[model samples]
Target chain A: MNGFGYLRPDSVHEAAEAYAAHPGARFLAGGTNLVDLLKLGVERPSTLIDIGRLPLDSVQELSDGGLRVGATVRNSDLAADPRVRDRYPALSQALLAGASAQLRNAATTGGNLLQRTRCPYFQDLDKPCNKREPGSGCGARDGVHRDHAVLGHSPQCIATHPSDMAVALAALDAQVELYSTAGTRRLPVADFYRLPGEHPERDTWIRPGELITGVRLPAATAGAPSAYRKARDRASYAFALASVAVVLRIQDGVVDQVGIAFGGLAHRPWRARHTELALLGAPATPAAFEGAVALELAHAEPLRDNAYKVPLARNLALDVLNRLAPAPAPA
Target chain B: MTSAPQPGHHSEVTLRVNGKPHTLRVDHRRVLLDLLREELDLTGSKKGCDHGQCGACTVLVDGRRLNSCLLLAVALDGSEITTVEGLGGDGDEPHPLQRAFLDRDAFQCGYCTPGQLCSALGMLAEAAAGHPSHVTGPTAPSGRPVPLDRSEIRERMSGNLCRCGAYPRIVEAIEDVIP
Candidate 1:
């Protein structure tokens, strides 16, 4: 790894100020992704602002019954929290489905959201990747793109965000809290990510010197029956080939409310707004679930090697939804 | 920013490794794995992939398991670290996991054994603390003791790769010592 400057900040203000002072400085929490990228030469920051010791490690209850998850809260601790496990099982399950026990123990929620895509082309400095270096070209678009994005991708990039926790958060309608030199602000989890558009280099809309403070999970959808399921090359310790996170609430045999998000198919968490729109107020039937899922997958324009992801995503979404809200038996 | 440390390429850190404290100057880019192996002269922790993909450099930091290769040494100041050497009992007495490994023939090349042992130790603690794995049931109660069945052991220890393919024996060794 290249030699760099390090500064351990004590508070959020200090951390933000440190970032503003250094042009290309990065905030290091767990260092699970950043350090690995440094070793691969994918990332080179001249300075690092260590924010692991900040007092933002608690998962507290908001006045409106929502959850305020501190940025530095480790993935393992957050997944094991009683409230998360019982109230929001999908979030807990998503966290467990990602990485390993060791990684979950060290990875932080904020860092997980900020992790880069696992595109081999992006990691290999020898390859040309628009996401790594804009205008350099996208190698994944033409070579070894079986794991590349199948939805919401552009000619400039075909990378997929690899955070299972972020996918679940999008389905749960969580909001990302950001602190900057000007002030603090909150953006919906779905809005926090960018769709790779023309500027694939900018993964998120976050501005420079902005620090992610925490995530706020609203209570409206917290108690719904939810789940996260992934189709991977292996049973565990592997990235998702396609995954779905579903939050369903059926009332009187009708789909009263639902939130859905697809991962490993897009630059960001592909929140299935169209699917949710079709599912709302409809009979919780197998046919309805199939139609809703098909409505979302219709937008997918899979590449040569990744045409299988379309079917994989459809099956995963249907499976999770059907299990969460089964059809009524024949009378 | 004024309250933060002055920007420098190196910093002095005191790390408590294997029950002993060592104070030294480390480059900001130096990872904890290098510090443990090179600076401390404790070669128990092996660097297989040198990245987070392979778990050969797994260690316990403040009682939690993490890939030491991904952790910057300067960032781990004032933290307690435990390597494979520290997992053993005092004075020639082997740790129960070590004894179980020997009895079960848990390793062939033994290069990944250190990381496997430390990861197993951390996995056990996590399960005891009600941490769930991917294989865990969604309906399982939170904060309840998780039953470390064969599947749980395999899933929890999936991060450690045994290139020697001693997985069956490794699983047996870990399962044998679970109370």
Candidate 2:
């Protein structure tokens, strides 16, 4: 690992200023991913702004009956929070499904959101990865592309986002609050992550010197019957092969509301807006659910080895929908 | 841009490990696992993959289990850390979990034993604090401790991998100690 300057700023203002002054500096929260990247030589920052001890570790109840999760709130604490477990069960389940207990205990919410892709080619410094280097070729395109993307991918990159929490947040319609020297601003989670277009190097819309302060979830999406289902090679301690996060509300055997998102399938969390529209006011039946999923998946363009992800994602979504759907009256 | 600190500069850090405080000057890139094993001569915590993929470097930081390999020694300036060496009581009194492991014959090579012990301690603390696992029933209310069945213990301890396939005995050991 390369030696670098370490700064422990007392205030967000100071942190932002320090980052602005040092263009090659990076924020260090939890260090679960950043440290790994540093050791791998994928990231060589000149300085690290340690934000682990910052005053942003609380999970406060918003005035509007929502949640204001601080940036430094650990995954374990957030998953176990009563408000989160009761109101946002999918978020809690997603957090629990990711990584291991040890990683969760140290990983922070903000750091989880900013985590990089898990593509083996990207991590290997010797390999040519466009995401790692601008003009370099993509090794995963023709070599071990099984875990690559199936949606929102481009020729330059096909790496999928490896975050279960971000998928849940995308489905819950959460907003990311960012702080900088300019001021504060909020962006919906859907618009926060960028698809791997020409510039695969940029993962998120967060600009330089911008720090994620917290995430705000609206009260409307809370308390809905939600579920997060993941399909992986192993039962635990593995990234998702295909995962689905769904929030469903059925009334009188009809779908009144729904929120859907897919993980391990695209560069960003694939929000099923079209499927949500197709399910609105639609009957809560197997045929309707299948048709909705088929319509949403029609836009997917899977690579060679990753074609299996289409069915895996479909089955996972269907299972979650079945679990969240209201039971039919007894015959 | 502000002048960056030069490479090879050592930073002064103070860490409280196993009820003892130690101050040392170390490189900025020194990891906590290396610090404990090399500088402090606390080799109870073994390094497996060095990356966070393996749990052999698991340790308790402020009562929470985390991968010591992923944490920088300088980053944890004043935090309290507990390793496998701190589990047992003074003089020949072994901790209950350690005793249970011996009784159950939970290990073979024992390379991952220290991490497994520390991780189990942290897992029990988490379960007692009402943190639910993936296998916990959906109806189980949040913030309420659930029954520590065989499946719950297995699921909670899934992070620590025993390459010798000593899972059955490991589970038995943990089950015997969960009161």
Candidate 3:
């Protein structure tokens, strides 16, 4: 790994100043992703601002009944938090479903959301990845594209986001709290990430010196059953081949409210807004679920090696909705 | 604490490992796993993948299991770290988990034993503290002890891979030690 300077700022304002002072400095939270990227030579920051010690590790209940999770809160603690487990079960489940216990223990919430794609081409410095070096070209687009994106992808890059937690946050309508020298601002999770259009280097809307402070989750959907289902190469310790996060409310065999998001299928967490629109007030049946998913995926343009994802996502969506549906009354 | 190091300079890092404090100068890029193995000569924590993918470098940092390879030595200043060397008694008395591994013959080549033992110890503590795994059903409340059944053990230990296929014995060894 390349040698770099290190700074441990105690407060957010100090961190912002440190970033502004150092041109090529990167915020180090948990160091699960940043350190790995440094070793791979994908990232070459001149300095590392260690934000792990900041007093941003709390998981507090917001005044409006929502939950505010600090940036440095480890994934393990966040998953095991009582408020998170009881209110947003899907978020907890999603966090648990990701990486191993050891990784989760060290990975922070903000770092998890800002994690880079795990595309083999992107990680291989020898290959031409537009995300790594703009205008170079994309190897995954023509090479092993099995794990690439099926939606929100362009000819320049087809790499999919590898975060299971972001998918759940997208489904939960979570908002991010960002801070920098300019001041503080908030953005919905869905709008924070962007598609890889012509410039895949910019994974998020965050500017150069911006740092994520925390995330705010709206109140739980009362009486709604939510679930996160991941289909991976292995049962554990593997990224999802396809995953679904759903919060469904059914009343009198009709879908009253629904929240849907897909992972491993797009450049960003694929918020199934179109599918949710089709499912709302629709009959709670496998046929209806299938139609809604199909409508949402109608714009999907799967590559050569990832066509299987289309059916896998559809089947997973059906299974999730089926499990959320109310059981039939006894005859 | 010393001021932050300048670019391309080494920093003085103080790490408390297994009840001993050792201060050393290391580059900012030095990982905790390498520092323990090279600088301190505490080679108990093996480096398998040199990344977080493999659990060979698993160690307890502040009572929680973390991949030491993914942690920078400078980042762990003043943190208490426990490795496989700390699992036994002061003398030759091995920890109960270590003894159970011996009885169950839980290893073949033994390259991954240190990580397996540390991970198991951490897993047991997490279960005792009512932390739930993915296999635990959705409705299971937080802070409620999750049952350490066969599947639960397997799911929890999935991060540590044994190329020799000593998984059954490893699971048995862990099961025997769980109280």
Q: What is the lDDT of residue A95 in candidate 3?
A: 95
Q: What lDDT is obtained when candidate 1 is compared to the true structure?
A: 0.92
Best by lDDT: 1
Where does candidate 1 stray beyond 4 Å?
A: A220-223, A326-330, B1-7
Q: Pick the candidate with the highest DockQ.
A: 1
lDDT of 3 by residue, A1-331 (tens): 5568899998999999999999899999999998999889999888899999999999998888899999999998999998888888889999999999999999999999999999988899999999999998999887999988998899999999999999999998999999998989999998899999998999999988999999999988787878899999999999999999998889888999899999999989999999999999998888899999999889889999999999999899889889989885667
User: Per-residue lDDT of B36-129 in model 2, one digit per residue for the tens?
Assistant: 9999999999999988987999999999999999998889998899999998845678889999999999999999999999999999999999
Per-residue accuracy of model 1 over B107-135 as CA lDDT, tens digit each: 99999999999999999999998888888
| Share of true Cα-Cα contacts across chains kept by each model | 0.85, 0.69, 0.69
Candidate 3 matches the true fold with a TM-score of 0.97
Residue pairs in candidate 1 whose N, alpha carbon or C atoms collide under 3 angstroms: none
Candidate with more favorable, higher DockQ: 2 or 3: 2
Note the DockQ of each predicted structure: 0.55, 0.54, 0.53
TM-score of each: 0.97, 0.97, 0.97
